[model samples]
Target: MSLKGKRVIVVGGTSGIGLSTAKAFLEEGAQVVIASRSSAKLSEAKQTLGGNVETYELDFRSEENAASLFKKVGEFDHLVITAGEGAMGDFRELPVDQAQTAFNSKFWGQYMTVKAALPYLNKEGSISLTSGVYGKRPAKGASTLAAINSALEGLMRGLAVDLAPIRVNVVSPGIVDTPVYAGMPEEHRKSMFNAIASQLPVGRVAQPEDIAEAYVYLAKNGFTTGTVILIEGGALLS
Candidate 1:
């Protein structure tokens, strides 16, 4: 894709799919600006990505800060939001308080971000959001995630219309082996992924790089809007 000299912003770009996508954009000669809640991760990511990519500290919770950052950065070509943590639990017993807090971070944060950055976004640019297969096919204990992801997909379609010429799209990845599962024991996490992989039609889960390709397509393709590029490893098929 010819993204030469295009300015791109990656929210939650410190790690995982976001980080991988930023690298891909830079390789395509896009000027990449990365944002995340953690300053330490941002610093680490910068050192790893070299001097080409810019880093910004942004907590999605703070709309004022996000607005200020976008205003300062001026009009950029594309905005890719990969913020939010994965939340999975029984729907009935999911702690209302914590789930609500997580929801704000995951769902509402994206909405707030788009609202803040809309004024500065170039008409030719696009806003790419991250959703997942869980929205369509929830697993056991994935009730919360399924609900939130479903809502997120809805949010993307709504933003597509609201934003008009500025494209809005979502990439739905299926269980990429990212740091999001760091809370689990290493051995257990690996085994879990292995087991899940065995069940998938593709015979593997996604890598960060695999899902990153979808973002590149959405950002570079001008005709694609209100689209969900599912990068799952054929999990839904099985």
Candidate 2:
């Protein structure tokens, strides 16, 4: 289960949970490659990761771009996709176009990434995807988010069966303090985090590092497949 010298690729790894997951792999002595669509973010990640990893500018939404990415990478041991943005709003009022975009990025994007990466993946390797707690314990005004995450988990299960021996799994994390919420007003954001934290038994909101560990575990554990590891601080219980 030791990751030393293993080749791991993390798509959408420039910031937030993706960046933290890359750092965790590095700490375990793995050869890490981080990919993002933004070249500027990639540069920042390189510096943050202490310059020992490879960086690729990848737009996972496009099949061609994803294929090009793996072509450059050649072959890799594990593929982790923590990219994609989810939309949050009332189902009735939310714009249909925006919801479609969310699904395209978060659900279809990961799907394409997996398809592109499979050819270049080692037979013994694994694929870890990202999901969210809303997929299971949805809240009001987050119907679209729930659908996207739920679809991802379903996809993972099917993939595990179809691509046997090459483990496929997902990490379903609850609220985490990542840049994904940067668009909200500062005060409102803090207030929201505090409100959720109070309900959780953990008594604190999760950080990127907290969720990052789940990805690491999924990659290292060969026996675990078609699983959704919930690192949600007992959110469903609360």
Candidate 3:
């Protein structure tokens, strides 16, 4: 689908899935803006994206920053939220603050972004949030992530109906080979992903580009709203 002239904002676009999505939009002739808490990363992203791209510094955990970022963004045809925080620990062992951080980043951060952008969104504009396969299929040591992602999906569906003409949707991806996993212990990370990938019908983890198409589809399809597009390589098949 052609997105020529579309004004798009991609939060957390400095790296991972968000960065790839931003590039995809730019390639489609859309003017894109990328926001992140990291100025260094944002500057690098701006240089890489080159034309018709803008970068903003935002730490979504801060209410003031979230509000200010959207205010400065003014208006846009689509807003894509791919920023999230992750924690791995048993529910009982996990610190409350750790869980809160994840919730605040993914759930509340998304809420704040959407709330602030509502006034500036075009009549036919769309909002897309990132959830994940964990939201649907829970796993050990991932309770916090699962809960937050599930909540995000529910929020998007409810908002889609409440927002009406302004479409809202969730993109739930499976294991994606992004920088987000760079911090994990190498052996454990490899084993974990290998097991996860083996279970998927496709026998492979997703790439950022694989999931980016779903976001682009949801944005262009006016008739689709309150929907969750699964980019999981059939991981949920079982």
Itemize residue pairs with steric clashes in candidate 1.
none
What C-alpha lDDT values do all the predictions have? 0.89, 0.94, 0.89
Q: Which regions of candidate 3 deviate over 4 angstroms?
A: none
Task: Indicate which candidate wins on TM-score.
Answer: 2
Off by over 4 Å in 1: none
Give the worst 10-residue stretch by lDDT in candidate 1: 85-94
How far residue 209's Cα lies from its native spot in candidate 2, in Å, is: 0.8
Candidate 3 at 150: error in angstroms?
1.2
- Candidate no. 2 TM-score: 0.99
Ranking by TM-score: 2, 1, 3
Question: Candidate 1 lDDT, tens digit per residue, 1-238?
Answer: 3789999999989999999999988888899999998899999999988888889889887789889889878888899999887677787877887778778888888888888988888899999998889899999888777877889899899989988898999999999999998889999999999999999998988999998888989999999999999888888888
Every model: Cα RMSD to truth: 1.0, 0.7, 1.3
What's the number of clashes in each of the models?
0, 0, 0
- Candidate 3 residue-wise lDDT, 59-150, digit = tens: 88777887888789897899999987877799999999999988888899889888888888897989999999888887788899899989
Q: Give each model a TM-score.
A: 0.97, 0.99, 0.95
Candidate 2 lDDT, tens digit per residue, 1-238?
8899999999989999999999999999999999999999999999999878999999888999999999999988999999998888999999999999999999999999999999999889999999999999998988999999999999999999999889999999999999989989999999999999999999889999999999899888889999999999999989
